[model samples]
Target: MMRDEAPIHAGKSGLRQILRVATTADHRVLDALGTKFDLASRSGYAAFLSAHASLIPALENLLDKGPVPPRWPQRRRAGALAEDLAALGRTLPEPADVPDLASPAQRIGALYVLEGSRLGGAILLRHVTTAQPDAPVAFLDHRSGERCWATFVEWLDGLDCGSDEQRAAIEGARLTFAAFAAQFRAWLATIA
Candidate 1:
């Protein structure tokens, strides 16, 4: 059965179901962010990276402070964002302070936003390549492509969290997305 048609089995695998349910709202935030920046220019791309740099590391640090699943890879893109910013001759912006994520489930939920971004990065990379072939795009490059996303989903599906933990994860994901939206808006205001 197709993913949308598949029945959600209750147990260790409901995180994926939660994420699937959240995808629509997630896409809306992503779309609004996309429209907020001009991907065709160097400054615009730098602005995008700056906006992301302000959040990615903060979320990653939050995840690091807790116990992450051993099988889950700790993929970080903030360093790449900094490198790209330097390569583009743009100064790195100070990282923003994200709210504390105190639980593993909440950390995982926030990570869902960061990890899922790789899927969209594939498309963004193509746009950057076409628009600024010489611009550093490491931040947008996910060498493993869909494999990374599949791995994350597989791990998420195997999580054994209870109802409260599940709710925390969902709340964490929502808050992370909202934080990104807020940062994007703030960045746009600065540039405007």
Candidate 2:
């Protein structure tokens, strides 16, 4: 009986209360609303919850004081392609309430354009600057992803592409991505 009064253990994380506040109208309930809720972490938790509502329960479960499940991967985005795909989902332009693509074709196309151009250049730059394998490895580790993306944008932004026809193509792609990325970030901030 005493244990029941003592925050009645609801899974390992802790006691959580969900409230359907009168002021808020929607599926949103005040998650983790409790007498002793930590105000310091509330904003961050809200952001995370907004981003990943489906996983909230699982996240709270894991927040309990114990070793996490063994099967979970260390990082959500494991490889280069996965990271690029995730960025496109988060960053590419779309309508305010329209659906993203069923397939990741557009994002992949953008990534290929970015990587093919800049990855080769980066490799060449590394080889020319230093003979040590570790130097190139470190460079790649620190800067490869962002550098490749920026180079693609730069190429699109009035950098010559050898011929007028090729230059026009690059410019079009650049403008499209630029417009889209701006809107996408704005939307992300709203939900963020």
Candidate 3:
């Protein structure tokens, strides 16, 4: 199906479909952020981690404060990012403003961005390993042998979100993506 088109199946799965559709533009932003960092040198990797340090903590804080289902696994990268930063002789950047995810649906959508990034972590881990073989990449390393995105989707599919909730979720995902992209770009500007 087209990126803009909703999935054929409706209901809870449709929330996932709509989120995917609505965040297509945000995906471009994320892709650009990924490319902006060279990732081939120590400084490049440090810059990348510094960019994440600015965003991850705030996002995790929002998720921590928001209403999430008790059974859902909390995926906080702030600690991992800090560990990687310290290992690389880098420090965490000041936290950025997190996207407002007030409702459960919105929190779920924001969580989707965090969980979904793991799908790309495997590839990033490879790059980090090649660039800095011994550098601590614990955040990316955690995805090893884990079906994180699949598990998240299964949990997402089980949630009972109506149309309004689905829209809120989509908005939350878009906002989270946008916030991360904006923070990364701003951080780059400061370093450059």
Kindly give the number of clashing pairs for every candidate. 0, 0, 0
> Which lDDT values do the candidates have, in the order given?
0.76, 0.29, 0.76
lDDT of 3 by residue, 55-144 (tens): 888777778765554444445678888999898887888887788788877888898887888877788899888877887888887646
Q: Which residue pairs collide in model 3, if any?
A: none
How does each model score on TM-score? 0.86, 0.22, 0.87
Question: Considering lDDT, which of the candidate structures 2 and 3 is the better prediction for this target?
Answer: 3
Candidate 2 least-lDDT 10 residues: 14-23
User: Candidate 3 clash total?
Assistant: 0
- Which parts of model 2 have CA positions greater than 4 angstroms off? 1-162
State the TM-score for model 2.
0.22
Task: State the lDDT at 12 in candidate 3.
Answer: 43
For candidate 3, report its TM-score. 0.87
